[model samples]
Each structure stands twice: as structure tokens, then as C-alpha cells.
Target: MLPTVRHLLSQPDLDLRLLTPATTLPERALEQSVEWVHSSDLSDPTPFLSPGQVLLTTGTQFDTEAHGDELYTAYVARLRQRGIAALGFGTEVIRDGTPDGLVDACLADGLPLFEVPYRTPFIAVVRSAADMVAEERYARHTWALSAQRAISLAALRPDGLSATLSELSHQLHHWVALFDASGTLDRVFPRDAFAGAGLPGTSFETVQREAGRLLGRGQRASATVLAGGETLTLQTLGRRDQLRGVLALGGVRELDAASQDVVTSVIALAGLALEQNHALAGARGHLRAGLLHALLGGSRDLAETISTEMWGPLPSAPVQLVVTDAPAGRLDAIIEFLELRVEEQPDRLFFATQNDRVVLILDRTGRLLLEDLCRTFGLHAGLSDQTDYRDLPRALAQAEQACERSKEGEAGVVEFDDISRQGVLAFLARTDAREVGRATLLPLINHDELNGSELLKTVQVWLQHNGAFDAAGRVLGVHRHTVRSRIELAETLLGRDLGTFHARADVWAALLATASVPG
Candidate 1:
């Protein structure tokens, strides 16, 4: 603990009395740095004065011997210009009395003056100040070590995570909570502090990003909780600064430097505990990556493996397959976020890619859960039917295809089956893929579209009507002669008659191909 100013003043070896002095100056005067001290008998002490110095001089220096009776008082103006810490005068050198002119000058100018009487050597006083500060630093370093040991023991005890945190809080005198990667409060020791409170705490998704930056810059952070009144957050980082957790102190008194160290040590210990927890949970986590690979490649065994290992033989292994548009390592954090969210549920499982596209699994209906996950993790997901593992790959494929069709799909959410076509949509999707398809009919479409002839429109209308020309003309809003002229013009461009079934089929396929290509 750092010694207070009162402690230094109370030192026995320094027999200093406050001459012309009272007890303490106002609190605002504490911030000044000491500049220099001198014991000179010159009448013009003001010339030697510099800003921030606690000028030490004998009382003779304040005498009006050479200058007028207002001489000592005139130094106040120069002292104010110097902005010194305080003027110290040895009372023995000037008859143990402070000059009235100096006293009056100080009160008028607001310059503090200290009267250093006999029996206390200035060297002894300076030595006492140095010793006090040095002792304070030593004490702080020792306390830091003791706290460090406690942190080490906190990680080793393994008595439940809550017990460890309780021990940690006792040592640091603060409330501690271990939040998993999910925003939910996984463990809050001394549960009474937040037992009924809906404040589950913010997620590592938010905290880690911030804590990581602070640790990266070799800085410690602290904040007051506006929501919880005196509640305060004093956080730094833990083991390799992995952002294990945050330490909070809620009290009316401000935390001292020692308290800050204790809280930081607790966070470091909590980091180790959490990393251990993660290792323990890794086996359960391995399925997510495998699930992602399986869904992407449409592998059956991978899905079955996930089902048997995670949500075994059940009535309905309700699941949603999310498809991410990224490759790898780019979205590890989002995948981790999904994992943490799923971990909260009794029977939820999720697999996601590095690009943040994901598949989430829950036993019951997942509309609420999916919405929560999307809002929490900040990733849009294509919701799919909750079927058994057998259908996951297909659901994922549909979601991905739907994503391709949605203009805003890259925003990272898409649902399969919803984007798929039916009837004319389905026919249009595959219209140009048939063997007697556009590869053989492109020349026909090119011929009609390039020539600006109405033949392509006529054929499209005729095909819609199943080859009924007058009906097609009615749909086209043109006369039969006009439609026939367009067809004749199309035939002329194609160097083939439009009467044959093969020629008509070619024109139909070409039109489909032209429409199917994404604009």
C-alpha cells in the first residue's frame, strides 16, 4: 500500500514543525511536481524561484533590510509568476517569526508558505519522503505477487467453476462471472449477486473483440456500470490474453491500484479455467466441422455420424442447414459464436463454415432460436425444415441455391426450397438443359434477335398457345398476317423453314436459354 501524506508527516525521525503553517492545503494543490529546494540568505530570493519548486529559504531572505518595507511583499508577484509549489522558510534564521509582510503577501496572492523550524534538517525531511514512496512500491509489488499466486491456485482447484470464482472474488473483493463465448452467463459465482437479474451479461463476441484490442495494446481497462449503479468493470486480459472473462467491482469506494491488480489477476486465472473448459468441450465440438463438410459435399455418413453422436435415435432430429459463402479461417469467429449459442440448449447442435454460413440443429421448432441466434451472432441464415440428418445435405443445397437467387443473398442468409421454382419456374430453370436444347438452337435465337424481326415473339406466343396461330396472334395483339410475316422473316434469317417440328423445337430451346442466363 502506498503511504499517505499524513504518514510521511507523522514520521518520528523528521522533527519538523509547520512554521507559519497549518495542517493541510486544499486537495487541488496536490497535483504539482516539486521543482527544487534551496537555503539561501539573499534578499532577492524571487530571482532564483522557478515554477513548481518548493522553494526552501531562510527567513533572512524575506527581510526588508536593503529594499523598502514592502520589499518582502513584492516577491509575491514574482512568486506568483514562478507558480512555485510553496515557500519554505527556516524560522531559526529569522528570529523564529514569519514576517508580517510575507504573511500578508501570501494571503493576498494565494501563495502557500511553509515555515520549517529548527531541529529538523531539510535532508532528513527529503529522505523521509523518498523512503515512504519506495516502501509503498515495494508493498505493491509484494501484493501483486501474492495475488498472482492466488490466481494460480484458482486455476488448479477445479472444485466447480463457481467455487473457483467465489475464491477469486473473495481475494479481489469483487463479483465475478464466467461468460462463455455465447452472450449468456454460463457461470456467476456467489449467484445471489445476479440471481434474479435478467442481465445475462454481454457476450465474448462483443467483449472479446474489445478486450483483445486492449490486451494487444498492452493496456488495462475499467468502466462504471450505468445500469447497475455502483457496479464497475475492471478488466484486462488472461493467459496469452485470450479474453477469458471480465472482473467487476460494485462498491461506493473507488478501487485502488492494488485492487486493479487483483482484478486483473482474477481475469487471468479465469482465462486459464475457461481454456480448460474449452478443451474439455472440444470432443463435442469436433462434430460441427465434420457436419459442415458433409452438408457441403452431400455426404450421408457424416450427417449420420452427427445424428448418432449428438442427437441420437429420436422421433425427429429437427435440424437446420446453413450454407456460408466463404472458404476457411475467414469466419472461425462466427462458427465459434454458433457453437456457444448451441451449447446453451439441451439439444441444439450447429455446424458452420469459416465464412459464417451455418446449419443449426434444435429438437423443437427453431423459429425463436434461429431469430435469437441471428440477432446475437449478426449473421443471416437460411432457415430450413427440421428433418432427420438424411435431409440436411439437400436442405443445405436448396438454401445455397436460394442464396444465389436472392439479390441480397450475400448478406449471409438464405433459405433453400423457398428459392426453388415450380411449374413454369421449374421449367424455365431447366428449359435449356435438354439434349435437344439451346446448344443446337442458339443459332436460331441469334438469327431472330440480331435481325430485329418479330419472329422470336411470334414463336414464343405460338408455343404458349400450343401452336395455335390465331390464338397466338390474339395474345401478341397483332394480325395473323403480321405474325406470319414475322415467322417468315425469322425463317429467312435462320436459312430454314419454320414448318418442321425440329425447327420449332430449336427455336423454343433457344428462347429458353436466352431467358435462363442471368442478366
Candidate 2:
């Protein structure tokens, strides 16, 4: 609350009189804050003056003998262009009274003009404004300290995170929102702050998109965004390597240094709360994993008792088991999202992690949720057929196998039933049969690697064409005779004849088994 022109004029000791008609000046112009008071006698003082300062000058720059309106107008225009808050003209010093030309310039330019009597020194005005600024600064600093104390107490509440944010919003007289690690809006203070169309210049969706981008980078950072006409500050919470969430303050155009300090304190408190919650979540995750192991070990009754006590009930008996290999970097975020989902529909979904893999047990109706999870996380999953709780071990085995198969496709999720329909070759992908096939094709593999020959590729292509030499040659971009020669050479390396269907079948299986293995 620095002194405004109106405030300065009201001071009895100052005895400043408005030279410009009070009615002619805009109310906002008169109320404009004066950051400092500067007195200059230079003809062009704009170089030393800053915006929002009251410029005081005696009539020394103007020649009293010369009544040139242009000189006064040009001088006033320069001060206006520099954004000087107001002009204070000292009268009875050099000239007899305030110049009528300067008064006319101030009126026409809409600059507030005041007259300082010769009895009052310019230093008195400077010190008066300085004391006012200091008082306001001190008041603001005290408010920040009080606000921080209140917020710290709020963090001691049972719902510390939400309570702290609510207190912060109240203190700032603005809105505050928290976004979880997955970029989901966890909560917003003053709950109805965004209830309807939301406040002007602040769109929750736009803020959320920005938060998502920052969290996706997985680093400790901060961003300031100007939306519509308002300003929003986003600060990442937690450590750089393990960010817990993002804290956003909206409708703040700018914060004074004191306000910024308060916000910093809130960020630290919020981050600590989230970290404590994370540790608790990790403990619960281990418990869930133990239940999953029990379900797979034929202890269905025991697992059900424990799960019912914790998360309502295990997904009803005939449930789908989904498995995915969770990347280490995103594992925490992934778990957090799943935990949120489970909380929303406790009876329909349950998840646990085992050795870098996440296993989900979902009711038949929860398939869509599983699909959404995979799509959102860019994960590949394998879903097992719905099976009774008693046979969860079999379902786990099937889901693990399908998860491996899902990695080879673009669908993101592969079901065990789909693989079963694909016949024996699909199942053989992970079998000991792969070793046998690799053994049978070892000679071709060795020859291709050693001689830079196309024997293995030619054999695979030829078999794919069902033994048609011309078709294989067309695919290999070689002559039919050369294809035949390569196939004959492959037969010699394997000590087998290629004319029979049995030999061709074995070679094709061998090729399929070694398809993913490096040459």
C-alpha cells in the first residue's frame, strides 16, 4: 500500500495542492502508486527516472521570459512517456508561480500535476514517501510470517495436504490446486473455486495440461503461465528424481518477495506430506503383494480374509488376471494411478507388484478400466481368461505367458484366449522347443554370420513361399537358380534333404523360434 497521489494530497503536513482539476483526472490515475519520489532540474530527466515515480522539479528548466507552449508540452510528453506517476512543480522558487503552459500540458496529457509550496522542501516529500513504502513493506513481511505460521499448523491436521493448501489459498486470496504424480487433479482448495465455468483467465483444463507436461519430464521444476489475463505459478513437489506432485497457484499476477517466501514454505510442507503418504503407500503395496502370493499358493481363504479387511473384497471369483512388465522409472507413478483406480472401484479392481511386474485381478466388468490403464501408461499387458480364485495359479501362469506374447504385437494387450487360437507355434515361443529349433538351425546361422551369406534368410523366405523357388527368389531379390543353390547349401549344412515336407516343417519352426534371437 505505497502512497498514491490522493494519499499524498491528504497529508496535512505536506500541504500539496492539486494544480490539475481533480475532476479531470481519472480516478485510477490519481490512485496510481508512487514507488519513489525523484527531484530533477535536468531538461531531459526521463533517463534517470523510472516508471511509477513522482517527479519533482522547480521551474528552472523553463524560461520564464519565454511563454512557448510547445516547450512545456514536449517536456511533459517526455515524462509521460517514461511512465512517471505524477509531476510535482515547485512554485515561488525560480518563477513567481507554477507555469500556466506546464499546467495546460499536464491537463492535456492526463498526467496528475500538483504544486509544492516554497515552504516545504523536496527532501521532506521524498522522506515522507520513503517512510510510507517502508511501513507497507514491513506490514507485508509480518503478514507473510503470520500466514506461514497458520499454514504450518494446518499441515499438522489429519488431512494435512488438503488443509495446508486450503489455508494457502485463503492467505493468498487466490485459488490453489494440487495435481498428483499422474497429472490428475487431486484436489482444489475452496472446493467450489472451479465449480462452474471457473474464474476469469484461469481454465482448470489448461492448467492441468501444463502440469502434465512438467510431471512427464520427471524433474523438479517451476513454470509461470499467463492465461487469459491472469498469471499461474506451477511448482513441482518432491525430489528431482522422484517427484510426488505439482502445486499450482492461480489468479496471481505477481507476488511480492514476502508472498513468494510464503509459497516456498507451503511447497516444502506439501512435499513432505506427500512423501509421508508415499511411504505408507509402499507399505500397503507390500501387503498387497503378499496377498497376491497367497492367492497363487492355494491359500484362497486366507487371502480373502486379509483382502476383505483392507480393500473391501478381492475381485469376485471368476476374475481376469492382467500382467505387465513395469519399467523401473515409471513404476511409482504407475502404482499411484492404479491405487487411485482401485480406490474408486474397490470391489472391481485389485493390483499388486511382483519382481518388476504388476499383476491386476479385475472382475469381468473391469476390462475397460484395464484397457484405459494400458492406453494411458503406454504399457503392454497380457490378460488371462476369467478363472475361479481356487485356480489363480493357473491364471497367473497363463497371464505371464500372454504378457510375453503381447510384447511382440502393437495391440498393447493380448489375451490368453487369443494366443490359444493361434495354435502350437505361438505357444512354442517360450518353450524348450526354441532351444531345439535353434540347435537345428545353428549351422545356417553360423554360415550366414561367418560368410555374410543369405542362406538362412533364403531358407526362411523359400519356406514362407511354400517351396516355390521363383516366389522366394522374387522376395530375396535374386535369381531363381541362386535361390536353389542357397537352399541346397543350407541342406548340406544341416545334413538333411529339403525336398520332404517333414524337413521343411522343421526348418520353418526353427526359423520361427530363432526369429527374435540375434543372428
Maximum-TM-score candidate: 2
Best by lDDT: 2
Residue 425 of model 1, lDDT score: 42
TM-score of each: 0.57, 0.71
Q: For each candidate in the order shown, give its overall lDDT on alpha carbons.
A: 0.57, 0.87
| Model 2 stretches with alpha carbons more than 4 Å out | 1-3, 6-31, 38-51, 60-83, 92-97, 104-111, 116-146, 179-225, 240-243, 300-302, 429-519
Clashing residue pairs in candidate 1 (N, C-alpha, C atoms within 3 angstroms) = 322-358, 322-359, 324-357, 331-354, 382-414, 398-416, 399-416
Per-residue CA lDDT of model 2 for 1-519, tens digit only, reads: 567878877778989999998788767898888899999999899999899999999978886467578889999999999999999999888887788889999999999999999999999999999998899889988999999999989998988888999999999987899988877777898898677533544568678888999999999999988875567889999999988889998884477678899999999999999999999988998999999988888898898888889877888868999999898767877887888787788889889999999999999898898888888778999999999988888898889988988887674888999888866764775466688888999999899999999888888888878899999999889999999999989999999899998888777777767763322
lDDT of 1 by residue, 58-166 (tens): 6655446767547766776677676766666666765756777777676666666656667777766566666666777788778778876766665566454556677
- State residue 449's C-alpha deviation in candidate 2, in Å: 20
